[model samples]
Target: MKKIFGIVVVSLFFLSSQVNAQHKIRIACIGNSITYGATLPNPEKDSYPGQLQNMLGDGYEVMNFGVSGKTVIRNGDNSYVSTKKYEEALQSNPDIVTIKLGTNDSRLPYRLKLDSNFIDDYKALIHSFQQLPSKPKVILLLPVSSFLKDSERQTDEVIVNQVIPKIRQVAYEEKLEMIDLHSITADKESLFPDKLHPSVLGETILAKRIYESVVSKKKMDFDIFSKIKEEKKNSSFYGYDCVDFIFKGRNCKVVKPRFSASGLPWVWRARFFGIEPQADIALLDRGFHLVYCDVAELFGNQEAIDCWNAFYEKMHGAGLSKKVCLEGFSRGGIYVYRWAVTNPKKVACIYADAPVLDLKSWPGGKGKSKGSQEVWEIFKKDFGLSSEEAAMDFKGNPIDLVPQIVKAGFPMLHVVGDADDVVPVDENTKIFEERVKALGGNIMVIHKQDVKHHPHSLKNPQPIVDFILHSVKF
Candidate 1:
């Protein structure tokens, strides 16, 4: 009798181990139409969650619990919590949850006073998942950008101004990892033909980014994981998180302050969105919000100007400071000056470093160094002008607008490399500085004696930060 009992016990233990080994990691993807595979050829097999499941392979089960036209805000038009799918999702016993619900909430008839309950409702939803026996890891997703205006139904303006900010605040407060869906999908206009939903290609990209974010944790070797763990802990102490949005089909990101600064000053960064973070991070700590619009390869033409105008209006409507201090690096010079020259009253000051003031110099490739033929082609295509037309059109270039910029009485600061051959100082900033000085404008140029355009900002960004703080007077 004892031997028989021992055999049964050992068999039961083996069966339990096998069952545990076969248990898959379950991911619950909860959201609205986009997650429902709206406008897709086949939502069931091609939705972002569907594609994500394939990427995650046989080890994971990704369930799509997306409800159509639902809002995360409980008081809004169609509250996600009120939906049957929300209950279904909770019952799935998921080990991970990804919430992507802000897009629908941004639509009209739903968003009326929706901002008030967004945080509390979002927290409640997260808490519901957290209270589960599995205690799933929750990841919040910022909604994708809207390419066209649908004021009667959906407007990206609200998403950019209201939804995204509240979502960021929730992520920061809850100490959860938030993904920048807006930034990744903002430039892929073709992927969203109807201007709202993602195509098959769009779903693929979304799935890939999500998969990368998930597997990045497991794939990290022991050494790298330890290093990252330490850095992440350190970052929590000194770092302020950034909320990214899509403004007029352009990617715009804002880093909020823990403590509000006086008058709410913001610095607008141009070109190379997240390359150098020392200055922007410092400014965030000092209670200044940092913003960026990805108008890459446009070279600041009329099209770029119009897009930026829309973004500025949205920000202003959202109660951002009236006058934005502009920070331009490399080719960003043109974007800075064009906007300022067109709307001088909207600009407080300008800080341009290794700026390409002339299209004919860098992108146009007409000057000292071997310029970018790729950029030159893009430049002409953007302006709808031939080489000769672009050359004749000095009206569009920043170099010709120096007198107007100077007359506007906005203080200017330029940090340039004297030895720079690409975007030669003689052709760009040197000439602008001389022209501005001749026109009796307030301009300051810091010459990095032996440096080239490669190293953009100062190692110690104190001077740059000081210039911005003084200019904004925050």
Candidate 2:
């Protein structure tokens, strides 16, 4: 009887251990050299996956299935699907999988086949993970920026212009969550010692980002409308509840939707608030919040940018989406474009109606339009332009910022009155469209045959609404 009791106790203990192990959430880190911690001193302990495990604590099991010089493209030089790590990752039976491949696929030899095989192979890989009995939640990661100056091997331009877009397309089509790792390391050259792989500090940043994305669960009890009501003055905006408040000494307003959207997507209106608000009304109907901050007469100056910067932080903290669709009308164009250029990653898309692209064209009266001398003087003073020549030489116009704006990779749409003497299409939208198209930037221009600047937005508003919805992936 004593021997029988001892056997039963040991068996019970073994079953308890198995149950505890199964309770921990398993995460499989799948990627190329960067995920493998190629250059790090101690990959096992200091790698991003290792660091992620530590950050996730005992409640999670993080497995690093990264292989060096691996490509997600099946026909690429070294296909990730063919690797032993891929098989092991499948065997891990993870609850979540993070795929961060693409760096090696950007190489010249492999890049040639990317157009044909990338999307198909990527889908196949995701399908493989989805077929697993675990049915893991797969997260796509945009590869980190490669600071390598070489044009052939992992160039930033190719990654940004080519590879990243493909990945975004796949994510959108697959309806998968994507973490923009490319933007995290962009312009942070010091963090990448060899220009190819991230240093230990950089790995820490990546790990923290992944942890925030996968491990941290946002509190569902917090309601944005409740918070707004508690803190701000309430009003009505086109039949919707509008909350008014002061942020950074600027008058701000947020129009609440009857039902909040899945992502809490929002449109940030610059300058104009309620004039010809068809698009705003439509967006509100589709469960989008309409937000505005009074930066009028600021002319998209440094002060305006600073005000917007603070306003953005407050809204993001209030649980709004990380990116916003920008709407600019007439002079409001300056405000939206200026802010978008500075905070490119923060913007999802831009819709400008009769926008003032070049200050010299409208306010400065340097172009065909009969300009506003009063506003021009204010603009010059705001920009610190000592004379007319200085204003002429000013390169801060949206037209001048086309390259940076294009590189930011956000789509733009312009609605212009072909016959308007004020903020003429020829000087503003036409020039902007031409320049944007030249650089392979995405821009759509809608010319209202005989309309003027007085009428802003479309009568139907369907096209504008569709553009915003598509850009934000709603």
lDDT comparing candidate 2 with the true structure: 0.86
lDDT of 1 by residue, 271-367 (tens): 8866655566556545566777788878788888898898787666565689998988998999899889888999989999899988888877777
Sequence-dependent TM-score of model 2: 0.54
lDDT of 1 at 62: 95
lDDT of each: 0.79, 0.86
Please name the candidate that would achieve the greatest TM-score relative to the true structure.
2
- Name the lDDT value of residue 227 in candidate 1: 16
Clashing pairs for model 1 are none
lDDT of 2 by residue, 344-368 (tens): 9999999999999999999888778
lDDT of 1: 0.79
